[model samples]
Target chain A: MTDVQTQPAISTAQPEDFFQLLKPRVMSLVVFTAATGLVVAPGSINPLVAAIAVLCIAVGAGAAGALNMALEGETDALMRRTRGRPVAAGRVKKNDAMAFGVILSLFSVMLLGMNANWLAAGLLAMTIVYYAGFYTLLLKRRTPQNIVIGGAAGAFPPVIGWAAATGQAPWQAWLLFAIIFLWTPPHSWALALYSAGDYAKAGIPMMPVAKGAKSTRLQILLYTLVFVPVAIAPAFVGLGGLIYLVVSVAGGLGFLGLALRLYRSRAGDEPDKAEAVGREAALYDVRAQAKPARDLFAFSILYLMALFSALLVEALSGLGA
Target chain B: MRLTPEELRARKRRNVWIAAALVAFIVLVFGTTVLRLQQNQASERALLEAATGTTAQ
Candidate 1:
């Protein structure tokens, strides 16, 4: 999968391109969840310290993203969806991206250790290693169950945030981690369902490419069924309140409903679930199969955002008091 | 190391930002530590005064 990309010699890379390398959209979610973890935990943090913690999480997330892009430049170039990424497109040199990620990772971890507690900094370091070293390097290329395990990396942000506030991760913080962990299979598999061709072309073992779209759809529905309860568990665990309860129950129903729709989208001409065909839009007939996956992908983002927003608002309002 | 003017200016700005952030964090941590120590001392003084019927001052 090694492609010799002709990088720009002088590297006229702009600040914006470097910013884009961070995968800002993903980092926003990381920052939001981490801030929610900090706020909802049962202690007070200095606002400055909280801000520094969130900034560290954001940078760590970005560092992971850049490193992922740098390492996957070859595969990314082969996939249409990611072909234009800075490292893949040679807008930024691969070595430069690697250096940028390593430096940011160091700065973020050290800053967090100094400003917050070492527990928070240690978790941040683990997140970087889990994502950049484990998930991107080993898991993503090896298994159809890649996201199921790799989801732990994304799920750690809330725990890190809680540790930042209280210097300890109680069971409640891990419940929040479970919410995101279970949420990942469905969210990513939906994207994988539609982008199966990209993965197949790049020789990645994404679920839809390895296990077929039919099984992927079924798994999406199953994971969402499991996701709803965990997403709502915070309310009973004291991490959430009336507002969070309302949002979780309502938002969860929407998520489950969409998953069921995606599962049932495979109508009378459904392909055999056992056929080990490499994924292609044409093979599955995207005109019939793609919409539900796309809808679920979009809705998943909204569901997480709304759930976390309610938690943030409740925490800020002193719900525990 | 020899560097061009524009590159040198940008490097200077980035370094300045990093330094300022570090300094601010150090001040916050230091101030909080001092405040915690002072509060502990005051509480101890109050306890002693209550026991002895005499303020430390």
Candidate 2:
């Protein structure tokens, strides 16, 4: 008789499953922001090399995402928002995802170093380690301030892009970094306030789950107050121009209004709509009580995109040059 | 010693993808090397021109 225990398991994973492990949606945002930094930095690079730099940054971000999913598969299974992820859904094995992440990480960092400067490559490597090792393994389960700290991983791509272009990370690059770093708390907490149920189910210490929704709302308002001025600061500092000034001011006001509305509302005071209904909830299909939080969450993404797009336009047109 | 048809198909497709990814990586490396060489040569030429002009002065 054949010994079944000695045989290697056959994999049914398709390429789509592997792609899903990269978190394509998040990668798109990374690519956009990194591209903006490359375009706006005060230096010129060969177009092909610039494209390669952005590609490496995107792949590096994706690699970190793959590693995050591989490590958090079981935990992800318990959360509705993340349950459909490839590793969590069993479409991709955890070990396979881990290997994929490591391979991509190595290739991206090495290629980026050869194409750009080592400073950019080193930043990409640090971002991977920060997200996959420090944030995923250590901070996520231990603190309610997890996203606040872990958000640095998301904020590094622009700096890497700037360094790729100039081989130096000056205050201008860090100003861009600060905008994302501060924007993260409000954006994340707004989503967390609406999805507190899923976070609770997964035993994650999201602000809404750990500190209650009232505190979360207050903190979101406070953060919005701080984040907007910084978002507008780029204009005064000569890093941004008229178009950016308009976008940041208008979008920042709208963001503030939404935060205020969300703060005054009773959103997140109850379990999430999915929990209440005992079923999966569409990301945008929240209950009337939760709509304010949802509005802030949705608007936050639009506002950030507009702000970055304005900067990109100004730079490309030589208005900010 | 038997494998299901679905398993065989998936394995074949995966192998194809792996080959594609490897080819893409090789092309990227080769392109990057060529670009770097061109950049270095251009900068070296510029430096030589500057030195020759200074010597003439």
DockQ of 1: 0.14
Per-residue CA lDDT of model 1 for A58-177, tens digit only, reads 999999999999899999988766888999887788998999899889888987887678999999999999999999999998999999999999999999999999989989899989
Model 2 misplaced stretches (Cα beyond 4 Å): A1-9, B54-57
Best DockQ among the predictions, by candidate number = 2
TM-score of each: 0.83, 0.96
Off by over 4 Å in 1: A1-9, A267-288, B1-57
Q: lDDT per residue, candidate 2, A1-321, as tens digits?
A: 376754435888999899888999999989989999999999789999999999999999999999999999999999888898999988888999999999999999999999998999999999999999999999999999999999999999889999999999998999999999999999999999888988898999999999999999999999999999999999999989999999999999999999999999999998766777767788767878889998998999999899889999999999882
- Cα miss at A38, model 1 (Å)? 0.1
Looking at chain B only, the TM-scores across the models are 0.67, 0.88
Worst 10 residues of 2 chain A by lDDT: A1-10
**CA shift of A34, model 2, Å:** 0.3
Worst 10 residues of 2 chain B by lDDT: B48-57
User: What's the TM-score, to 2 decimals, of chain B in model 2?
Assistant: 0.88
